[model samples]
Target chain A: MENLAIQLENVSKSFKYFQLKNVDLTLPTGQIMGFVGANGAGKSTTIRILMGLMQADSGVVKVLGHSQPENQTLVKKEVGFSSEEMKLYGAKNLAWHIDFIKSIYPQWNQAYANELLKRFDLNLEQKIKQFSKGQQIKAQLLLVLARKPKLLVLDEPTTGLDPVARHEVMAELALILRDEDRTVLFSSHNTADVEKISDQITFIDRGRILDSNDKESFFENWKKIQVELPSETLLFRHHRSIGIEQAGKLASVTTNAFTPEILTDMQKQNIKVLAVEKMSLEEIFIANVSYRRQGE
Target chain B: MNLRLNPSMIYKLTTKDFLLFRPFLVVYILICALAAGVMIAPIEGAYYLGVILVITVSIGSGIHFALTSVIIEKKENQMSFIMGLPINATDYAVSKTVGGMVVYFLNWLPMLVITLSLIYFSHLPNGLIPISILCFLQILTGVVVVLCIGVGTGSEGFTIVMVVIFNILFNLFLSVVGQLPGISEFIQGNEAVFNATFFSVFGIEILALILVLSLTLFIKSRNACFL
Candidate 1:
């Protein structure tokens, strides 16, 4: 528990229109976990709970070894929270904001803030409203990063960036998070964005986490195998496979629990194995979501 | 949980909001000073003109302050930025309420003093003081009502609507208070009278202000989720 930066067990919340069922999550320190979810998939809601902006209806929530909502003030001091819904006072410049924030957080590192000011290429004196959307996100990141927080909770940090800006933001995050002492919970709907920098990934949909694993485990365990269709097409099926796509003499079977044994098992059934293809993160997410919803 | 305010953070947040409203405050104070000057001047018809100017600007300042400083946080999507800081729901609510009340006093206090001073220093009837007190209290209460609604709902539209309603009610309050037996009989006397009618109305106004403000804070504290 001490080694964990965040822990949520059977945490649940209900609203008039939606409900987050019993949710259990854990994130060890020094890991960048991409919280991937589609729109309104409870990414932001869960993050808000972790940040102590909302109280859980039941169960436990602890961040950095402290209880939630109860210790939110203490937790908030150590956590840097940024979201698309967050905006700085547009009437004030970044410099003014920096100073205001600095006054509140005793641990605010002025030297790092100065360095980030240069690295992010933000004009300190310009009002935040005058900044382009990309610059605005960069400014938000810079403020969060310079705080030198124990954990960074970013909810959809790249939702509205253009391709180039997205690349730049991702590149900067990848570079900065190379330090193993800091932790991050980066949430987004874009699989490519999560795939780029997350050491670990947690996929959520409709208020439930579908899957959570390391990047490699996700890559290694899910696969799309190309095969030649047998005369008895209906006879080609595997217990480990979640879905299949067939076209004439060709067939592709997607398996979540992939193994060399599955390929061997397929060949014994008279289906000619062509090749085993690795699935992209996006493909795996879609297939998994589709399979889970259909099965439920 | 209790309010659990960190004094330093609350102070910073309160000051931050106050600074944001300071420029508007400067301009509004100027208008207030001009109106006060006119009220005290010996120029013909200046007192009546000054009375109208001061009353309008007094209410105007409260509405402006509530619009810009209180409701604008939620209206402009900046509440998340504030909530992201090292504070809790209670801290945000208290700081906003404190800052909002400051706006209320900035305009109302000066006008209160000016009106009371005019009756005391000049040859005007001192008995007008009770009515003057009621009028100032009405303005102060109006601002509180607006501030409470703004803080509670963070709705600019509803708060503005209430502002209009409060102004209309302010005029009606004057008519009703003028017709009260105790106030009407002694309105022109040489001595100022503080009657039961004055006490009754004053008590309710004060009670409403305190209750409304308390209710705002209570709701915010009890509702843990700010976002």
Candidate 2:
């Protein structure tokens, strides 16, 4: 069996005001793991530690079967990282940067770089400082993408892009996944993008991972059940229900473990089920975070 | 902990700095040329002032290199790009320290050689040679201190404060070195000479440079986490 592309066991880090606690994550090869989190939700910190840019204060972190901040140099050779905090050289033009990165990485693909330059509508002669934010991001992505690394760890890669640029970047990333051996792990606050492309979805908030599961199961299990309560009697809350909001005699309950037994439980309580709708990734993420934050 | 520093990686990293600061290098060369012209012309009052200018330019070039490559890189969030390469903290810290020192030495070396030539060929007292060498070592000490500040601290404000402190210490050192007994006596004498005091002060400066560079590396390794 092939080893996991990324793994973290009980990883934790502490800043002055925030603490990332017991962050456990694992992603096997050939899967894109979308690390979904709000701003300052430890996504960037996790990604940085995973990339070996920073060391975790506690716990083990292994990327591509090598330990972090120790085997970082070896791990880095095969792992391509593109982060918002990292910028292209401003004084150098895109072509110069391409050449610079090409010189450092032996696996650089000139043909693919040229294709990305055309697809991203980036001018090779333009200085990086002069490019629009979207253009700069695309240029940075091109540098990493051309290396043809075994794993790609992108942190907030689509944060500042326009809709069209985001779409193009996402499309390119999806195309990269066509290779059966390559794995991707990208962190994003934009749930739509994560939901669209990720095979595994991990939600993090307040420096804690609230939920991590396969995308299909995450969608399938989180059902927003709408019910009409009889009279003023409160219905029996199912064990799996994470959140319940009541308005007059109507109730909307969010559950992580949607099952036939949940409907049966409601039926025994004389609560008439009106409709059960699938929760969007955004909704599931929000409910999960809010529930966890309330000390659940 | 398993990572070992690669000399080739350090060279490549240093080359990147040299290429990026080529303009500054050119400016340094021109300033040295101007200093050389003044020395050759043997202008009466300009001779001593020209020496000061050349030394100042050499030291200033080092400070600028450190500020631009280290402090500014941190301020502008460019360290991420460097650390993203296939190098760990030791590689990064050592490369920057060695790179900055190499450039500083390269800039200071030519000036040192030119000044020595002037002392050897011209009518200037060779006694000034020993004293002048001690002063040049102080200049190297200053550059190393500035490099330490840049690499050891990520705070831009702290770096600025330290640089200001560097300038003040540099001026204080110049006056102190000028007032030392052997150096003072040498300035008033006619022949090249060396005394125990000259060696002591030179030795102290050399030792301080080594200590500060070590401390900088230690600090760098302690706070190696790239944001």
Candidate 3:
């Protein structure tokens, strides 16, 4: 197995109204893991725990082979973090932040920082407070990326950016993925962005991890099958599958285990298949959250 | 693994802090100049020094409290950035403490020079060296204790409370000591009290430094939740 850059074993955190229970996650070296969750699905909370910013109530969190809260300083050195909520000095210009970070991290890539600065169309002289939301996001990215950390943990890096800025940020991240040794774990509610760049995707809902797999395997396993059930029969009720919805005699089935045998089995049950459609990451996310919410 | 405190990194942080404190520097200089004017206007030497000391300490505490609590942390979102940095949190905390101390020293330097000039011009009977040494030790001890409180409580109001209480207690303790009839007689009879007290204060100052350093390291190691 490739060396895992991040590992969370049976991690759990609890609050009065919300609880993250038994969240197990693993991001091997050199893979971009997109964490998909709803607004209050505990995405940022998990990321914060992983970054050693917040401690998990119970569970083992190891990043870069260092135990968290104890070895956070060592782990932080090799990890680059950027988030929507993290802001730089408002009065200080970009150059000042650049110089400041550069002074700390000896591995800072000056050329890469300059390249990103040019690409993001951010002037070093511009005060961070005066920059637009998009520009600020780009500037934040610039600061983190230049550190050339082994792992990058980003929380909603493109949440408030316009389409063009989002595309710019996504494209830059894509270029970073070209390096086979760098690992990225980013959380986003925007499934399109996740779909575009993630090698692995994990869906979280109501503080529980609903599904996690490689993007290819996840796509391969889940299918939205539209079927017409016989008027007198309930076909989905007898099926052993992950999710199924019946509206009158018409049934829509989503299976975690999708194969040629499933189709044949459905046919044997006298269900006439109307269409078998591939589900996008967004559809999978919504279906997962909604299904769990409905207590399915 | 890269855990050394690079001088360049400290320098950068210091410079950044200095720049952020530019406006305060101007105000501090003005205050120091005003204090110097008071000291040099042929006033009684001890009274002028006492007034200048009170004013300097009050202003220094206020500025330090404000800078550490409201301005610096608010401006950089420094808690997050500093937490994310590769350096140990203890080092980061120490950097802030040292940075504040440097600023505090800068604020006092002008006043010290002015007081020395006053002594030289007036030819006061008091020895300038002992007074200067006492002032230095007092200020040094005050800065460390105040900065530790600032960093530990992570609030300006807390620092203010601590400083006020400390000043009150210190004044009371001094009053009590001075009232002991034999204490003054012994001090006046022997020249060793001045040196002993100065050295004792210096030793306590060092102890305070060690205590604050250890506490800061503990705080950093705890990895308390921060935005």
lDDT of each: 0.84, 0.83, 0.73
Question: Which prediction has more favorable DockQ, 1 or 3?
Answer: 1
Per-residue alpha-carbon lDDT of model 3 for B1-227, expressed as tens digits? 22345455455666666776666666766766566556545556855575556456544644464455333584556566666776454455556676666765665566566555555565343344444444544555566666767776677677778677756655554555444443434432313235555566557667876777577646654544442
lDDT, residue A157, model 2: 89
lDDT of 1 by residue, B67-176 (tens): 77778888777888888888888888777776567655765676677677767787667888898798778887788788778878878888989998999998899889
Q: Which residues of candidate 1, in runs, are more than 4 Å off?
A: B38-46, B110-130, B178-204
Candidates sorted on lDDT, descending: 1, 2, 3
Worst 10 residues of 1 chain B by lDDT: B98-107
True contacts kept of each: 0.83, 0.69, 0.56
lDDT of 1: 0.84
Tens-digit lDDT track of model 2 for B62-141: 77888888888776777788777888776777777867778777777777777777776776767777877877788778
Worst 10 residues of 1 chain A by lDDT: A229-238
Per-model TM-score of chain B = 0.87, 0.88, 0.69
What TM-score would chain B of candidate 1 score versus the native chain B? Answer: 0.87
Ranked by DockQ from best down, the candidates are 1, 2, 3
**Model 3: CAPRI class:** acceptable
The TM-score, computed over Cα atoms with residue i paired to residue i, of candidate 1 is: 0.92
TM-score of 2: 0.90
Interface RMSD of each: 1.2, 1.8, 2.9
List clashing residue pairs in candidate 1: none
Q: Which candidate is the best by lDDT?
A: 1
- Which lDDT tens digits does candidate 1 get at residues A155-198? 99888889999888888777777744678899999999899888
